[model samples]
Target: AQSVTQPDIHITVSEGASLELRCNYSYGATPYLFWYVQSPGQGLQLLLKYFSGDTLVQGIKGFEAEFKRSQSSFNLRKPSVHWSDAAEYFCAVGYLSYNTDKLIFGTGTRLQVFP
Candidate 1:
């Protein structure tokens, strides 16, 4: 069985500060990993994905993540977060064996920015 879990329900960070969001998954084999961001009442936009190759992947909006196979974790990180970066982050796993390219998403992590 494949599943994803985000331990942090919500997080608050000051503008221009570094940020980190946790993500953990359970899967039988190596799965395609992705991180998406969604603003209030908006659709999700792909930040980045790790299919193979590099363990650390860079993403848009000054974000990056490192995939740790041993730990079963893919944690997102940002050197300096902007106020506009405040949104809901979801970690997802894509199963190629499935009929459709559907993603199994984590509960979600809400990011709050303080000016």
Candidate 2:
């Protein structure tokens, strides 16, 4: 079965500190990987995605992720955390075989930025 797991249910970081969110996936072949951020009552916004090519991919909102095939991981990272960055982060996997663009999201990791 194809699925994604976010090990950390929640994470807290001081403002201006570095941040990293763990993500692991189980899928056959190279599945499309995505990181999305959602504020309360807001829709999911694409942070980054790995389809093919370079292992490292850059994304919006000063976010980046490295796709490690061996580890089956696509971890999200940021140099400095901001209070506004506090939100729910989700790791998602998209099926290539299915035409539907639906995404399977992880339970999610809540980020709390402390001043």
Candidate 3:
């Protein structure tokens, strides 16, 4: 079994400051990592995902993440934060088994951007 951990439950940053959300996973093999963002009362939106190939992958909404095998981390980073970017961010680990796909999600980190 694998799990995702988002150590930070809440984070506050200046509107124009840089942002980084930590995400760690526990898995024996290389598993898929995903970052999703959800606005208030909205559905989850895919930020980015890492399956294989490049360790660093780009995503929508000016977000990107680098899969660090050594650290077992796939952290999301944005050079600058905007007030509209404030939302609940979730880190998930997913894989296919027995022709079925499963995803394990973290508790999520609520982002607060101050102007």
Candidate 4:
């Protein structure tokens, strides 16, 4: 079965520090990869996605992800961190099952931004 994995369960970064959250996926063919952010008491927000065309895709809130086919990774990155950035980040991959679309999400990586 196809699945997504976020190795780091938690990460701490100071304000204005560069951040990178690792994400890996297992799929036979190309999958639709997405990065979503969730803050306390808030719904999930789509950061970015990559299906084809470009390997590197820009996302909202100064975020970006690069899809590396060889590494099967779609890692999220930000040049600087903000206190508001503290939240749970999820990596999801879209799968087509019996004509139905499905999204498999990782356990999630909790980001803690210090001021």
Identify the candidate with maximal TM-score. 3
Q: Write model 1 residue lDDT over 1-115, tens digit each, in one string.
A: 8999999999999999999999999988888999999999999999999999999999999999999999999999999989999999999998875566878999999999999
List per-prediction Cα lDDT, in the order shown: 0.96, 0.93, 0.96, 0.96
Residues 1-115 of candidate 2: C-alpha lDDT, one tens digit per residue: 9899999999999999999999999998778999999999999888999899999999998999999989999999999988999999999998855666767889999999999
Residues forming the 10-long window of minimal summed lDDT in candidate 2: 95-104
Ranked by TM-score from best down, the candidates are 3, 1, 4, 2
Q: lDDT by residue for model 4 over 13-58, one digit each (tens)?
A: 9999999999999998889999999999899999998889989999
Model 2 TM-score is 0.95
What is residue 109's positional error in candidate 1, in angstroms?
0.3
In order of appearance, the predictions have TM-scores of 0.97, 0.95, 0.98, 0.96
Clashes of each: 0, 0, 0, 0
lDDT of 1 at 16: 94
In Å, residue 13's CA in model 4 sits off its true spot by 0.2
Weakest 10 consecutive residues of candidate 4 by summed lDDT: 94-103
Runs off by more than 4 Å, candidate 4: none
lDDT of 3 by residue, 1-115 (tens): 7999999999999998999999999988888999999999999999999999999999998999999999999999999999999999999999988899889999999999999
- TM-score of candidate 4 to 2 decimals: 0.96
